[model samples]
Target: MTKVKVENLTKIFGKKQQQQVALQMVKEKKSKTDIVKETGATVGVYDVNFDVKEGEIFVIMGLSGSGKSTLIRLINRIIEPTSGDIYIDGQDIAKLDKEELREVRRHKMSMVFQNFGLFPHRTILENTEYGLEIRGVEKEERQQRAEKALENSGLLTFKDQYPDQLSGGMQQRVGLARALANDPEILLMDEAFSALDPLIRREMQDELIELQDKVKKTIIFITHDLNEALRIGDRIALMKDGQIMQIGTGEEILTNPANDYVREFVEDVDRSKVLTAQNIMVPAITTNLDIDGPNVALQRMRSEEVSMLVAVNKKRELLGTITADAAAEARKNKQTLHDVLDKNIITVEKDMLISDIFPLIYDSPTPLAVVDNEDNDRLLGVVIRGSVIEALAETTDENEVMDNE
Candidate 1:
């Protein structure tokens, strides 16, 4: 189910007259610079539309001045929109009164900012329960909830410590726990890890991933880093000049970029780390174990023009593999295909990253078999060296062209 839906959302900054003129200019398809020059107004977000599904991480990403921060602020009505609708689970929050909005922010959504916004004067536990405290939750119940959130954030032992007494990463964990203490249905994180050192940032990212697995809250994460978006987002919206350029899964955006701008953003990304066996694998060439004998196996191999053929049972469960040479030898010796089957073939799970399959591909004489891990090791497809090379090379060439232009 869609947890949030934004349609034709816009936010303009300037005088009322200039904002109205800028909004008109946006509808007329005028460039942002031209609109600003003509009307003396800045478009924070213009006609941006997207949806966030329940319990999924929806990342909004762009370079500085791209209005990513503004777009996120509009979602929670922390910054009111100039036009359009912001729906949270079918309610148009854009029209909500002050009290209604406050209740929404209190119970349905919570925000975590870039600057670890923890109270310096308060203990970590107290800081965590601050939201609940303001909402008039009973002291004992709020404390219990705060302690649970802190434990979940891996900051339980540090609950007694103040913000200044902890590392930057620990302080950020407190901010996360604070957000969790309210048990909001949605999390709005605006560059929550951007302030940390690289190592600490990665650790926080990992922790968030683990935390999400446990809590399953719908997260709307804002970031300027494409890699971070690709790593954490279930889907990503790439923005520029207050408009959404494209929205898709990481693999979709990488392999089939919407435009040259997106191509440029992904040019330097390591495709091996992003691409997986399932992304490039072709259908497995196989022969049935019960029905097909050595002669039939050889014929199948000849027809497919492959050196080896995978053998499967009636249910398509992988039994073994047979080489052309083995099949021919078995046929000559009047033996069944199973008698010459080789069970030592290299295999990779369908979800295994291409980088992880390099060693297996290098050592295997034939293409690496891709199997469904959730299934009974059923053969899904095969990933040849050529296929892997071609997938990576194609993106590189496209990216280089984009960069040159």
Candidate 2:
């Protein structure tokens, strides 16, 4: 379902005369006035539209002053829009009165800024609990929730320390915990990790992904960094001069550039990191033998020393996987491995995260498995982690050429 919708949104700054001053310069071929007017009546955002899916991390990216930040601010009503409708969960919030808007901000959404925004006088626990406290949550309930948020954000150990006592990365986690403690459905982030060191930023990005895996809240993240957008966003919305130039998945934007602007943005992307198991898995194989007995399956397991065995129907298409225990159970029951084998499987479809393989890397004696798309369950290929890492290394080398060029 669409969690948020922005339609024909535009935000223009300055007064009427400032706009005219700029327009008049164009007619007279006046360089000085043209520059003045363009700067004076700048359009922060113009006629933009898009929808954010529930539980999606939708990113808005552009160069500074490209209206990326302004667009984000408008969605949250941090700044009133020049004109357009902003909808959250099918309700048009643009026309909401102050009290209604405040309610929305308090209950439905929470934000994290570029700076940590921690309170100097409060300890980390107090800082994290501030939002819940403001919403009039019971002190005990809010404190317990804050502790969980802090633990998830990796700030539990520092809960008793002041913000100044922790590193920048730790403080940002506090900021995240504070935002998360409200149990919001949508998270609005404005360059939330940009102020950190590169290594710290990378760590925070990974942490954000982990959090998303667990919670799946809809997120609207604003940034000027293309790499950051690709790493964290489920879908990216690239903006230029107050307009969205393109919106698509990271791989889509990388493999099929929408225009020169987007092409330039992704010119140096390392493709392998963006690729998933579906891109390289082998075709599924089928075999028909009445070895459904547990003794036969145990023999196969001992012979192969495999962690799991794939079970298929007559066509060799995937049905599910069975582990060693099932084979033993089948033997005890005087049944074939086929009889006791499980057909339900937790397989990755193409476009699944490369990181998804982390669990599977050490999961079986065989390094390869049938790949499927998580969205459609369509088979893709068989993949091994070694090949993925090699592909990433090759992509890194390829990216270096563009950097030097």
In angstroms, the error of model 2 at 256 is: 0.7
Give the alpha carbon lDDT tens digit for every residue of 1-405 in model 2.
Answer: 999999988776767766455445533544433445465776667679999999999999989867899998999899888778999999999999999999999999999999998889999999999999988999999999999999988789889999999999989989999999998999999999999999999999999999989878999999888889989999999988777889998888877889998988887766766767765565443223343555555566677766556665443456566677876776677766566656555566566656566566546455455544343444344566676676666677877888789
TM-score of each: 0.91, 0.75
lDDT of 1 by residue, 1-405 (tens): 999999999899999999989989988989889998999999999999999999999999999989999999999998999999999999999999999999899999999999987879999999999999999999999999999999999889988989999999999999999999999999999999999998999899999999999999999999999888988888999998899989998889988999998887877887877888999898889989889998888888888888898888887888878999999999899999889989887888987888788767876777888887688988888898888888768767866876798
The lDDT leader among the candidates is 1
**Residue 173 lDDT in model 1?**
91
Indicate which candidate wins on TM-score.
1
TM-score for candidate 2, residues paired by index = 0.75
Model 2 is weakest, by summed lDDT over 10 consecutive residues, at 282-291
Q: List the residue pairs that clash in candidate 1.
A: none
How much lDDT does each candidate structure score? 0.91, 0.79
